[model samples]
Target: MSPQRLRDDLVKQTKIDVLTADQAKDNEAHMHTVSRSFLTDTITVPTPEMMSYAALSSLGDAVYHEAATDALEKHMARLTGKEAALFLPSGTMSNQIAIRTHLTQPPHSIVCDARTHIHKYEAGGAAFHSQAAVIPIHPANGHHITLEEIIHNADLTSDIHFALTKLIVLENTLNGTIFPQDEILRIAKFAKENDLKLHLDGARIWHVAAELAIPLEELVSPFDSVSICFSKGLGAPIGTCLMGPAAFINKARWLRKLFGGGMRQTGFLSASAAYAVSNNFEKLFHVHELTRRIEKGLIELGAEILSPAETCMVFYDPAPLGLEYAEILERAAKLPDPITLGGSRLVCHIQTSDQAVADFLALISQLKEEKKAEGWVPPEKTHVNGNGVIRDVYVRPKAIH
Candidate 1:
């Protein structure tokens, strides 16, 4: 289907005036000024088609327990191509449960990228919930940690006073980097030889599948356990699934309840996930294309686009224009129409499009070209290179530290 046709269908299905208010409010809390019409997500709601699935989204209290577990088990089993899957309200819960289940012994350590979501974004949930110490390895560039690094670190593993290596957690499409199947196979072999349980944080696995032209199951097959998120790029309202051994998920269900992640009649939410799995998968490809277009545009404009446009994220450190982070974010939030970004986090989802891409490019051009006086160099702007003499030029400005 054409993107325009799908958007029209979504319009009939979604209620633009009402469905998007909540999102705007949510965005407002974070300093965003947006109208409902600008959103691309169908779940942004008031859409009639999305409402048709109310039967699926509305689960009774007892059903929340049964359906949540059922959804988790069903999807996860398919994900790892494994025995079971468990549902949790948040990825943090699923990850914590995975860690706790793997670390049956005390003082066990989890090896993961230093920028792993579990380490960088999930607060100290691993420490507070699992009580396990993290062994972090930074990716040489972006979030793509090398398989050789995993092996070197794991082979040098020890049972000394320090925590014993218990689990190897990898975020596929690390921070913003995506790994190929060959890399997964290599790391999985190393993980197996050393007897460490491997976990794949497939938060953006769906995005990777679209980008790499690989099946989700094939992409995640090497890991012993896999955690998948429906909310990120999949555009589900909320939910994450943890797939592993049936026995492991059996324990996970209880852990989810303990963490207050259990919901009643969760098939309502899972139904959206089901819709995403069935109908929404293709849109991710559009997101990938749009991201490439935007990143390329940025580069063409002389901004240093970060590498690994592997999935949905496009990270750039715009120098010279290195203004205050707060000011940069503030500008992003207030952009009039067909634009947004307020959080300093630039990401693309299924709803993002070429129009949005063009809008963002135009705004960036404006931001980059604005100068205090004539020419490109603004007196306030400054950058220092290897040479002692710092030169000023017109370029994308990244926030200074």
Candidate 2:
């Protein structure tokens, strides 16, 4: 089937409702979103409330100024205990700038976990922009990468045949599991001993810090460079900061301009980030509590959780429930307090409320009871590829976008 047709079939089978104009307006107030990284869909574009807050700000910056952008950079620098920081347009830009800045010479490589954002989600931008190859270390448990594993993959020899490894990139809260503190310290020592620059893909570092009750600065003090997204879990609309040494940030600033990340009058966005750093950072602990509530409820309803809830993300396998993916989503959408399920991964953010989570748990409980009464048979695994090919492939929840 064509891709569009497959989407149509999935929507139809799932009974996904497209809201009309009036319904959409009502949804603005009552809809419960369980699978988003940001505060809400309304926050994607600035709402009137956001605008009002942004309007209560000072004048904007031209290229670089000391008011908003400078304050934000300084705030992040202090939070991460780095010498300097630069605000970039997106996490991708921040991460790539760090990669390119670290690997100054060609034929350099970066060692990271196999499922890292740079390895899996950055669209090969590391190689495209930095001309660096990535050596991904796949963990046996498929959660956290140990220092031993990282050392096993490290190739620091100055051989002409192999690409020189210049950096070791680590991701905290990779798929909601915090990289252990001792492991992180061990890796940092290893990187220093091996003459490898350590970079942290700390897109969700806020979540990790909150989970461990560790201050952000202490958490990221080991790495040479760190990329953090204010937009994700921090409730900022759009902004990411690359924090590192003064010289490293100076190089990254030039690269940011080259990559079209330099922006004018960005105080409007930075002001929001500043607000989030002060306001929303503490709320992540509560969000994780809500996530655990959902996870515990789901397990009671016979859902097989794929991983333990660590921060704001939960992964589960729904295949054992004897239901197709589309059907599972259909039941979820048809609930009285309807939910918009995103495959098998459910994420909680600042806006995910206790009542919303309770409603979702109720919906799952209802489905489980219905399934027991119906004696439904397990269906063959039906999967759709990116190109719309139908195959008997099992679907797993994807990492946070």
Candidate 3:
């Protein structure tokens, strides 16, 4: 084909508009929906003010160290009291990269809390990316893991019979329960004496600081490396920063490229994250308060609080009221102003409205009344599935029609 004809064809195929004619109205509706959602904080959308500010960011390529990206990294490094920081697309990448960078040799293992995102939700990235074995340990107290548990489970031998434990990972606000800082210090001391590296999956570490009024530097000081996300409770559109010593982050920056996480023109994304830290950090306190309200409401309606709102999430069991999560999910969606839920986890975010909390409690109260009218009784024993695992009752929404 002639050059002119090829150019014309490419233009014709690429020139298409994604926006609807009523884009403004649609966006307004979406904002309203997000305000009422208790599904997860990751669903929270960026505000127009944040987007407007992002538009003016430097248009530099991130692989070559973009200006805004560099600034954000520096700010995060200072904020977390680390020597340096590197930005990645998601918290998972930040975490996996940290793991890959820390474990240079094979036949190694990482000791972590049983309910950590690294082990449960990262799709086996530690094993896949670094070829490292994971030792997941449950805490006896049922909240945060203790130093004794780490000492008991960690493989510290060099008998060539077991994978040597080189790293210890912990999560802040795992299931919305803050990992006690005092315990973290104790573990940190153990890690130091044993020459083991300590890392933190601090995606919601902002919540710990917000709830307890602790400084970020002090909160993360115990860990050798820490990954903090801006998208979850802080409501940034995208990006997470992995902070550590200058050498560790420098190596992680290279691995970030090898993992195909390097981006071009990341100035806008960095600016959005910076805005989240500046504008949305204080808002997390309100999110935690809202979460506590949901916990209190569920308790008043006779639901069992499996996990209280230590931060921005609460896990409750409605079995005490003879209600299943599936029924509650269906009923809440059918309300005049619908509220969204995800199984037992109710995560309140910066955009969550007071009215949403009130509506959620109202729905639970109504469901309790309906169950009473139908002569439903709470089971003497907890509901168990065929596999003998107690059911939490997560259900996908059926067709509306």
Candidate 4:
């Protein structure tokens, strides 16, 4: 289907009236109990009937090793136009396996936008796995690296006195804008000429593919390797896939095992992943439209919306800080506190609806309109203990002045 059509139809919205008042209340009540950390992404576990084809594949725990991997390999290879593909436990593992396989040449380096997930998160696994330097390029605002930026930094004079840029990675729908094909093509051409491997961190590749109206295969064929996560917007509970030449995939499989990713019967996760790829993806395109709705809603309220919501993420910095960060942190740290859901760092996903959006807006509105006469009790109100100051007594809840 055309990306535009998919976007229009896949996220086809149900009218607010279709939901009974009780159902709406139930959803909000559910959200109250749900942890905000889990709400930060679209990867909530599915319900029992969420596309589970028990008749076709009843072995819940079976990883469908031969079948699932074969399906995964074929799916990835067809999508990437690569010779082979393999599955890993997580996107982290998938990217790690690919990097380890390609960075065989010592002193090899990867060039990426500094805002990449691999750099910020993952707890430094790249160094432990590959022992290679990851050179940071123009990494900002989700760090999208451009072609000219590459040509400007690349060493055409000689390979020595520089980390051989073995890999160049680009993320799509990066900071909510898909890279124009010309840019991707230019980088691919640059990589080819410089003997560099082009890897695509296509965790959310569907957004780019759906936005550009290009089949993923056509868009990703130039990449030497690609890592796609099923658990992100794809809505799967777990699993990630890496695509590349058959030889490269064979090497990745072995490394996956070495990383303790080899599972006895992971079909449970794979099954869930397969179901997510087919059914959940249609919902992702709709998120784009929903984001537009939120952006417009926030803007109309006279709030300075930081930037328009493109995909599922929309961040807005609240003004005149209704509450301090430290207070929010301390309050949030209290175990089982439902107020954490009201954190400034809001996120949206499939479970969220228009009414829920309204409630969140209302919550934020209430938070901002109120005033406080004082901050948290200073150390002056507390007594010093051996290692820490102790509150002498509970400071009465400051009345909203």
Q: Write the per-residue lDDT of candidate 4 for residues 1-401, one digit (tens) a residue.
A: 99998787857764246676697567656554442431455436554554454224434322235566566558767877888878777877887788888888666677777667676666776677888777767633443578877776655455577766677777665545566777788889988987888888787787777655688888887889989878777767677889998888888878877888876655556667778777777776676776666666656643444445757666554433334434544544454533334333345555555554654455445444543334422234456666586633322221110
* Top candidate when judged by TM-score against the true structure: 3
TM-score of 1: 0.79
How close is each model in CA RMSD to the real structure? Answer: 10.4, 10.6, 4.2, 14.6
Prediction 4 global C-alpha lDDT: 0.64
Stretches of candidate 1 exceeding 4 Å from the true structure: 1-47, 56-72, 141-143, 155-159, 320-328, 342-344, 378-401
- Ten residues in sequence with the least summed lDDT for candidate 2: 35-44
- Strongest candidate by lDDT: 3
* Candidate 1, residue 355: how far the Cα is off, in Å: 2.6
- lDDT for each residue of candidate 1 in 1-401, tens digit (9 for 90 to 100): 99999999999987646455586566543322222122323233222344366455635463245553465457658755888887677777778888877778667778888878788778887788887888789776544677877766653446476777778898876644687678778888887887879998887788778877887778888988888887766766777888888888778777877887767766666776776666677888877777678678878876665554666666665554444345555665576642545333356666554666787777667777773233554355376766676756434444211
Each prediction's number of clashing residue pairs: 18, 0, 0, 6
Q: What TM-score goes with each of the models?
A: 0.79, 0.84, 0.94, 0.74
Better of 2 and 4 by TM-score: 2
Q: Provide the global lDDT of candidate 3 against the true structure.
A: 0.92
TM-score of 3: 0.94
For residue 153, give model 4's deviation from the true position in Å: 3.2
Per-residue lDDT of candidate 3, residues 325-354 (tens digit): 889999999999999988888889999999
Q: Is candidate 1 or candidate 4 better by lDDT?
A: 1
lDDT string, candidate 2, 1-401, tens digits = 99999999988897855767796566565433433222232233333556566676667663666377888888889888999999988888889999999888788888999988899989999899989989999997678888888877777788898888889999887877788888889999989998899999898899988888899899999999999998888877798999999999999998888999888888788888887777788989898998898889878776678887889878777655655456767776776666666666777787776776777777666666677689965556587877798755445546344
lDDT of 3 at 267: 91
